[model samples]
Target: MSRRVLVTGGASGLGAALVTAFVARGDRVLVTDVREDASVPDGASYLRLDVTSEADWEAARAHVEEQWGGLDVLVNNAGIASGGRIDVATLEEWRRVIDINLLGVVRGCRTFTPVMKRQRSGHLVNTASLAGLVHPPGMASYNAVKAGVVALSETLQFELAPYGITTSVVCPSFFRTNLGASLSGSDTVLQSIARRLIDRSGTTAEQIAAEVVRGVDAGRPVILTDRPGRRAVLAKRFARPVYEREQHGFARRIKEAAEGAADRSTTKDGA
Candidate 1:
C-alpha cells in the first residue's frame, strides 16, 4: 500500500536516502529538516522543521494534516551526536543532545501517535545507533541519547500494539557518509569519536535505507541494519558476561592511559 510518510532530516545523509527510496516506490513523502534546500529529490515534497521546537512540530502537524489528511508513517531521523565523558560534558550540551535526539522523537510520537490512533493503523520509524546497544567509548552523550530513543521506541511499540500501530527503531552501524566530515567543527572528543566510528564502520546509507524499507514493509518492531548490530545485541544479551568483560577491559585501557599521563608529569618534575 502506498503510504504518506513524513521524514525528519530528510534532506541529507540516511534520511535523504530513505526519502529517495520511499519516493521511488510511489509513496507520498514529506521531507523536512531545519534547512530545506533545493537538493532534495524531485518527487519528495520539502518542508522546514526544527525538531526541538514545539511550534515547529505543531506547524508541521497542521501542514501534514492539511495536505495528507493524516499521516501513515512518521520517520524520526533527525539527531546530532555529542562527544566527551558524561562529567566533562556541560549540562547545556547534554540537554541539547537530549532535546534533538530524544525529545524530538518523543514529540513526534506525542503528535503523530494520536493521528495513527484515529486511523487505528500507522507506523513510526525511529533511527537510533549501534552505540545505543553497546557501551562504546568517548561518546557518552550520543550513546545516552540514543539509548533513550531505543527505550522510548520499544515502549511505544508495546503501548500502541493494542491499537494495531507499529513502531520500529532502527539501530544502524557506522555508515559511509559525510557524517564524519560534519563532526570536525564539533567538540574535540566528539570529533574523535565520530572519526573512530565512521572510519571503522562498513555500512552504507543505501544499505540502511533498503533495510528500513524492508522492515517497514514487514512491520518489524526493531530494525538492525548491519550484521555487527545483531552481533552486538547478542553479545549484550546471551553473552552478557563476555560483553561486561570487554567493557571492563576498555575501562582498564582508559585507566592505563590516565596513569601514563600522570607518570610522565611526575618524571618531568623530577628532571
Candidate 2:
C-alpha cells in the first residue's frame, strides 16, 4: 500500500537519501527543509519547514491534511551540529543547538502525534547520533541534544504503543554528509578531523537510509546503522565503565591529532 510520508531536512544528505528510498517504494513523500534551495525528489512535494518553528509545523500539518488527508510516517531528520568544550560554549550556543536538535524533535512529535493517534497507525523516525549513546569530549551540546532525542523517542514508543503509533530513534555513526558545513563553535580542529574521518569512512547516506527503511519495516525502536554505533550501544549497556574509558581514549586521540596538526602548520610557517 502507498503511504503518505514526511521527512524533514529532506534537502540533502541522509534526508535526501530517505526521500529517494520512500519515493522508489511508491510512498507519497513530502520533503521539507529550512533551506530555501533544498531539493526534493522528482515525485515528492517540497515544503519550507523550520523544525524549530511551530508555525512551520502547523503549516505542514495543514498541507498534509489538504493534500494527503493524513500522514503515515514522520521522519524528524533535521538537526545542526555543534562542537566545543562545555565551559567554552556560550549560553546562546547551547540554546541554539538544543532548540534545533532537541526541541525541534519535540515540536515535530507534538505536532504529528495527535494526527497519527487519530489514524491509529503511524511511524516516527527521529535522527539521533551515536554520540547520544556514547558521549565524547568537545561535543557536549550536540551530544546532549541527540541524547534527548533518543530519550524522547524511547518514552514516546511506550506511550504511543497502545495507539499503534511506532517511534524509532536512528543512532548512526559518521557518514558522508553536509552536517559538517553547518557546524558551530570553537572546535575548528576537531571539526576538521571529524570531516576527514567521515569522508574516509566507508558508510554512505544511501546505506543508512536502507537500514532506516528496514528498521521501520521491522518496527524497531532503536535503529543503529554502523558497526561503531552498534558496538557503542552494546558496550554502554553491558560495560559502561569500559565504554567510558574508550570514549576518553578517543577524545585523547582527537586532541593529540589536533595538536599535531597545529605543530606542523607552525613548522611550515616558520620555514
Q: Identify the runs in model 2 with alpha carbons over 4 angstroms from their true place.
A: 239-242, 257-271
Clash totals in order? 0, 0
lDDT of 2 by residue, 1-271 (tens): 7889999989988999999998988899999998776667677999999998999999999999999999999999988878676666788988998999899999999999999999998999999999888787877888899999999999999999999999999999988888767775776776777777678878899999999988988999999998878987889899999988987897898779778978999999999
Kindly provide the TM-score of model 2 when superposed on the true structure, using C-alpha atoms.
0.92
lDDT (C-alpha, whole model) for all candidates: 0.84, 0.89
Model 2 residue 258 CA deviation in Å: 5.3
The 10-residue segment with the lowest total lDDT in model 1: 184-193
lDDT of 2 at 263: 97
By summed lDDT, the worst window of 10 consecutive residues in model 2 runs over 181-190
Per-candidate TM vs. native? 0.89, 0.92
Give me the displacement of residue 254 in model 2, in angstroms.
3.7
